[model samples]
Target: MVQAQVTRREFLKASALVAAQVTCGAWLTGCANALAASAPPPAASDAPAPIATPTLSRELPFSGWREVKYYDQLASAVVQCAQCPRRCVIAPNARGFCQTRENRDGKLYSVVYGRPCITKTTPIEKAAIYHMLPGTQSYSLGTAGCNLACLYCQNYTIARAKPEEVESYTMTPDDVVAAALKAKTKSITFSYSEASVAFEWMMDIAKVARAKGLKVILKTGGYINEAPLKELCGALDAINVDMKGFSQTFYDQVCQGELKYVLETIKTIRRENKAWLEVANLVVPGYNDDPKMIGDFCAWFKENLGDDVPVFFTRYEPAYRLRMPPTPVETMERTYKIARDAGLKYAYVGNLPGHTGANTYCPKCGKLLIERVGFDIKQNQIAKGKCKFCGETINGKWA
Candidate 1:
């Protein structure tokens, strides 16, 4: 049977209904029930099911750039980008190091505004945010371009590309919020690509999402400047920062960014107090997997963010520019132990599914509070934001 075509008006009405359900706290549970009831019976054929492409809004013509924020004008039509640590000073008709922002007539403009290359609804845990709103879904999106050039970037195809080099869908702030509501996701996540490259777009969509009572989460490398990071944090509800490594030398050689700036961004996020923060450290073999370095990272995390902040030691896989052997599971487990030993209460091992380290336990009583297999949460015993067994309050947006 052919599916009936949906007009824009009908789509808007449906989105409004879903938004209402979300506001009433009924969307997630209702969606779960609907999925179970509509489950298909076993099929004999082994052919893969066709994937459905998301129907995006019509492309909006642009003048190729929009006025940027957080920059300063310099001598002879040169503009200094204060967005990130690089602070690229562009001459007339030049672009920043990220290649997303350009200086047109001495005025900095973002070329990637509202042009997203990816959009989907994913589990919140996939963002490596194992604590906040566990088992929930988020509307995730990303645009091409990134401030940092990490050798082992998994999304390097888009992250390292200019806006003009990728196919993107045009979405305004209203369009993004509408899409999130239609997807029935609890939050909107800026992910995959470096969100800082598309800063204006993310900030605008985040503002709209917050106005509509939806949360905003950021998955970033945390290489942004103080002013911009503080402004973005105002609308953010949760953030997962990829810390990369502990040493400045490793950051310079492997990520093409500074360790100090990322650390400053993390500290700013904590100081803002508007967002719950989590950190991830990808352990690359022969690069930054030293036990002493891991221990120092944990100690710094404990000192700055405290013992309650969740940290994940993720196993690295060969991707993009890096072709080293995948990080061993034992290495990830050992790193996890180092964090735990350094006075961190919540530490986990990622990319090694079904390992006991992926589970969350009550800090007070050591009883398993949240059990997981990969990004799937099998059991969550957090009641009223406290451990069910010990009544110890967990630090997260559990609702």
Candidate 2:
């Protein structure tokens, strides 16, 4: 379509000067014509201009800084952070438990904004959100730092590193949207490490992405405060919340977070009627793999989030500070059966490729609606979000 309105000759002539200047990083427009003449072939110059690119911006890549747009300074030099449930009253140079935000010199400044250390375009299915949009791709990006210190965190390299310890590129909100457009992704994910930690950047990028009709997904631990979550619900399309465990003991001893707060966050997400919500429980052996506990968890989910809310029991590997053996595949299969018995309609076993339980089955007819092999989708049998066999509508955001 760009070619229909503008001929190659006119387009080339119009863009030659800007292209020459940008290519040479030169501001001397007097030499633009000459530069274009001596430059490479017309085919090179005919290439379309980029939507947005990287820039020079510095943000801390650690759990060591505070960022807030709304806060008040107390007489004791404490800043009241309204960002998360932590609502930390931070003293100068002190950090939150998330270890990313900090109070510096009586004011709060989030240091991870616009400086993402990890950025890539990946399949949306890889985010493990099978029901949201199957086989679509999303632009995934994240900075360092997390609010929760889950000992079994899978991406701890960037998740646990400081700004100086990792490499990052500067980008604005527009750059993120451009990256999504350039990659032909249908959605963008604030993922890899933790989306809540880099809230400001995400808010900005989501605005532009939504304007462009691109979807947004939040791959989170559901450790965020209410206000931010509500603000984010405006632009977010889907969310996958990690339900680490069912008990406070596991939340404190294993994840170093509050179970009640995570539950509250999930409830709020459901109440807001915002975003397609899915829950994931990492089934760690000898930690949270007990059948009774898993059953209780499933029952709670069925009551609170409903039976239609899909739950994923992901097999845990030995990583980070926990060097224990990986969870047995048999255990994951057993848990899947337990969840099924607990009245949950859509329960899945993740991280074990080619497992029969990895595919999505119709809860009513017991027919496979979607087939999977690892992250690859081998087959899809749904028509307009209804089961092909039973004609019952699947409870998910299947677009």
Best by lDDT: 1
TM-score of 1: 0.85
Q: In model 1, where do residues sit more than 4 Å from their true spots?
A: 1-64
Task: For model 1, state the Cα shift of residue 86 in Å.
Answer: 0.6
Give the per-residue lDDT of model 2 (tens digit) for 260-323.
9889888888888878888889998888898989988887888888888888999999889877
Each candidate: how many clashes?
Answer: 0, 12
Worst 10 residues of 2 by lDDT: 20-29
